[model samples]
Target: MIEKIGFPLVLFAMLAIVLVETNIMTSGIIITIGLNLALALVLTQILALLYGFSKSLKILNKTRRHPLYSPAREASVNAQLRSLKK
Candidate 1:
């Protein structure tokens, strides 16, 4: 997660520096844009994390509702027990 946001933030900072050096934008404007971009990136990361968490919860619920022991499994176990007794 850190790598996902950190790399892009580093690139944005470098770009802001270059833009400022080239006189393409003022410091205040660059700062504002950089902050907004960072906010957007962080929000996107949070949304992605939430989406993944929801998916995991859904899978967990499905597994919990599924029966671990069915009739066939019970029969198999009983057969093994009988064979052992014999």
Candidate 2:
């Protein structure tokens, strides 16, 4: 949820900053600083989301590389081994 909204939030914040600078919207120093801070926060959230995705991908690749990690193949192999033992 946060990841999806982060980008739009950043864009909106940037637009607000532009509006403030252009005097199209009446605002004060505090509002400008607040908008800048909000922009930084949204950007940080985006970075965190990217880092989390990378970590998940790494974990998925590691699991895929394991010899017995495939569910269908492991089930068939298990059945064959049981039949041989019997």
Candidate 3:
């Protein structure tokens, strides 16, 4: 599902709104907490994607050292390596 709203932001907004409606917190407090929670939630997703991409790049770099990395370098190259199967 496409999340139009992040869970954290929704949760915070709900709680803040409820508190204000109940006279537990003021509207000013809701504005403060809601904005910060939204920012933090978005940053979390951004950082997760950044780290995941880094890990993928590292795996590709490591695999490039393997002989099978490029199976069809050239016709002669494959002939030189010989078939792994007997």
- Give TM-scores for every candidate, taking all chains together and pairing residue i with residue i: 0.47, 0.49, 0.49
When 1 and 2 are scored with lDDT, the better candidate is 2
Better of 1 and 3 by TM-score: 3
Q: In model 1, which regions exceed 4 Å deviation?
A: 1-10, 13-26, 68-86
Check candidate 3 and list the clashing pairs: none
- State the lDDT of candidate 2 residue by residue for 1-86, as single tens digits: 98998788767777777777788875877567658867788788899999999999999799879986887986798899999999
lDDT: the better of candidates 2 and 3: 2
True-structure RMSD, every candidate: 11.4, 10.1, 10.5
Give candidate 3's error at residue 55 in angstroms. 0.9
lDDT of each: 0.78, 0.81, 0.72
Ten residues in sequence with the least summed lDDT for candidate 2: 25-34
Task: Report the backbone clash tally of model 1.
Answer: 0
The Cα error of candidate 1 at residue 74, in Å, is 16
**Highest lDDT: which candidate?**
2
